[model samples]
Target: MSLPRQLLLGAAALSLAGFAQADIAIEMHAVDKSGVGKTIGKVVASQSRYGVVFTPMLKGLSPGLHGFHVHTNPSCEPAEKEGKVVPALGAGGHYDPESAGRHGFPWGDGHLGDLPALFVNDGGTADSPVLAPRLKLPDLEGRALMIHAGGDNYSDNPKPLGGGGSRVACGVVKSAPK
Candidate 1:
C-alpha cells in the first residue's frame, strides 16, 4: 500500500475505534403506581476525556415540564414518604449521596443529582440531550432515572424539591449487555 493510503486508513481506523469506547447506554422506563416497567426511551451517554454527553430520545410523556434527576436507588415501586405512599418512592431522594440538600441549576454545584428540566411537547414527545457536567456515564450505574410529575424551578422557595411533585417515571441504570 502507498504511504499516504496507509496513513488515511490508519486514521479512519482510529476514529472508528474511538466510538467503540463511548458506547455507554442508559435506558429509562415509565413507572406509575404499578412499577418501573415500560421503556419510554434510552439515553446514550458518551463520556469524553473532559465530560459526558447524555443524548436522550424520550417518548410517551405528558405534555409539560418534568423534573428529571438521578435518584439514589434502583427500585421504582411506590414506597412510603413521610408516612404516606408515593409513586416511585422506593427510588429515594435525588442522588445526593454527598448530602448537599440544595437545589438550583445543575451547573451551580447544586444537588449532585440535579439535571436540566425535561420539556415535553404538546404531542407528548421530547427529543433533546440534557447535559450534566457534574456526572460521568459510570456514575449512573445502580442508580435510577426519575421523571417527576411537575416542573422544577431548580430552587427551593415556595415548595421543596423544586416542586417537582411525585415521581412519575423511572428507569434503573445498568451496564449494557456484552
Candidate 2:
C-alpha cells in the first residue's frame, strides 16, 4: 500500500476506535415521593482527552441552575427518610469511593462524584455538556446520575451536599454489554 494511503487509513481507524470506546447513555427521569416519573431525556457520557464529558439532552426541569452528580448506588428509587419517602434516596450519597466525605469541585479532592452544576435555560431545557476532569468512562459504570433541585456551590460549609435540596431527576448508568 502507498504510504499516504496507509496514513489516512490509520487515522480513520483511530477515529472509529474512539467512537467505539465512548458509549454510555443514561436515561434520566423525574423523581418524587411516589417514584420515578416521566422521562426527562438522556445524558450521553463519552470519553474525552480531559475526562468524561456528560452531554445532557434534558427538558421539563425548573429553569435555573441544577446540581448534578454521580451517586453511589445504581438505583433511583425513592427511599424512606425520617418516616417519609424521599426522592431518589436509593441512589445514596455522591460516589465517594475514596471516602472523601465532602462536596467540592469536579477536580477537587472531595467526592469524586461532584460534578459541574447543570444549567437549564429559561425554557426548562438542559442541553449543555459538562466535563468531569477527574472521571473516566469506567468510573461511572453501575452508578446513579442525579439532578438536584437546586444549585451546587461545590462546598459543604454553608450547606451540606452543596445544599442541593432534594433529588429531582435521576438515571442509572448501565454499561453496554461487551
Candidate 3:
C-alpha cells in the first residue's frame, strides 16, 4: 500500500475508535401525574479520571431538590404499577441488575443506579454538575434517567428510595457524538 494512503486509513480508524468511547447524553423531558412526554432539559454524562460526571442543563423544574437515578429500562412511557398508573413506570425500577432491592446513598453498596440529588434553583431550572464515582460511561446506555418530584433522603427507612415521590421527569441515555 502507498505510504500516504496507509497513513490516511490509520487516522480514519483512530477516529472511528474514539466514537466507541464517546460520552453519553440524555435529553430530559417533562412529565407529570397525568403521563409522560415533554422536552425540558438535557443531561450530559462523561467519564473523567475521577468518575462519571453528570452535567444537567434543566429548566421548568419545581425549584428544589429532585432525586435523580438511572432506571433499568429505556422507555419513559407511563405504565401501571401496583394497580395504579404511575408516571414513567415503563422505565422500571432503579437500574438494579443484581436485584439488590435496596435503596441507599449512591456511594453505598446498594442499587448501582443511585446517583446524586439534583438541585433546582428558584427559577425552576438546574444547571449544576454532579459526579458518581461508581458509574462508567457504558453503564448508562439503554437506561432511563429519572428525576423525582421530591428530595432524596438517601435512605429506605421511613420512605422507600429516598422518599423521592413520583417520577416527574425522565430522559433516555443515548450515544454521544464523536
> In terms of lDDT, which candidate is strongest?
2
Worst 10 residues of 1 by lDDT: 3-12
Best by TM-score: 2
| lDDT (Cα atoms) of all candidates against the true structure | 0.72, 0.84, 0.78
Candidate no. 3 TM-score: 0.83
Which of candidates 1 and 3 reaches a greater lDDT?
Answer: 3
Shift of residue 71 alpha carbon in model 1, Å: 0.4
For model 3, the stretches where C-alpha displacement exceeds 4 angstroms are 1-22, 176-178
User: What total of clashing residue pairs does each candidate reach?
Assistant: 1, 0, 0
Give per-residue lDDT, candidate 2, residue 71.
97
lDDT of 1 by residue, 30-147 (tens): 8766566788887665654434445567888899988988888877788765777777888888888677878767666678888777778898887655556577776777888888
Residue 158 deviation, candidate 1, in Å? Answer: 1.3
TM-score ranking, high to low:
2, 3, 1
Candidate 2: worst-modelled 10 consecutive residues by lDDT: 3-12
- Could you tell me every candidate's TM-score relative to the true structure? 0.79, 0.86, 0.83
